[model samples]
Target: MRVVMSVQIKKNASIFEMTREATPKEIDDCKLVYCGHGFFDEADIQNNINKNLMD
Candidate 1:
């Protein structure tokens, strides 16, 4: 039997606070920002990548 690790960020994460960047507007006031699940949905993934790379 093997045990697997599951990644989840749950409510109230402090990881971002340690970083320099202020909470982005996209994540609902930074409180519920990262839940460790799906940074972006399938639809917006391409757009975000393009914007970051192109612009």
Candidate 2:
């Protein structure tokens, strides 16, 4: 999955102004992630998104 977002700086803070899913082509070309010693998958991504949204 990919996300298109607009960030803003206000009072020395960064705020996410907008966010949307990115296209397959965009994800393929621009996706960047460093799993390091951890395992990552679609379920991990979905879980993280859900957790953040709840907070």
Best by TM-score: 2
In candidate 2, stretches whose alpha carbon ends up further than 4 angstroms from where it belongs are 1-41
All-Cα superposition RMSD per candidate: 12.3, 10.8
**lDDT tens string, model 1, 4-47?**
23333424322222222334653556443332333444556546
Using alpha carbons, what is the TM-score of model 1? 0.26
Q: Candidate 1: what lDDT? A: 0.38
Q: For candidate 2, lDDT tens digit of each residue in 1-55?
A: 3343555444533334224544577547755222222223467754654454454
Q: Give TM per candidate.
A: 0.26, 0.28
Number of clashing pairs, model 1? 0
Best by lDDT: 2
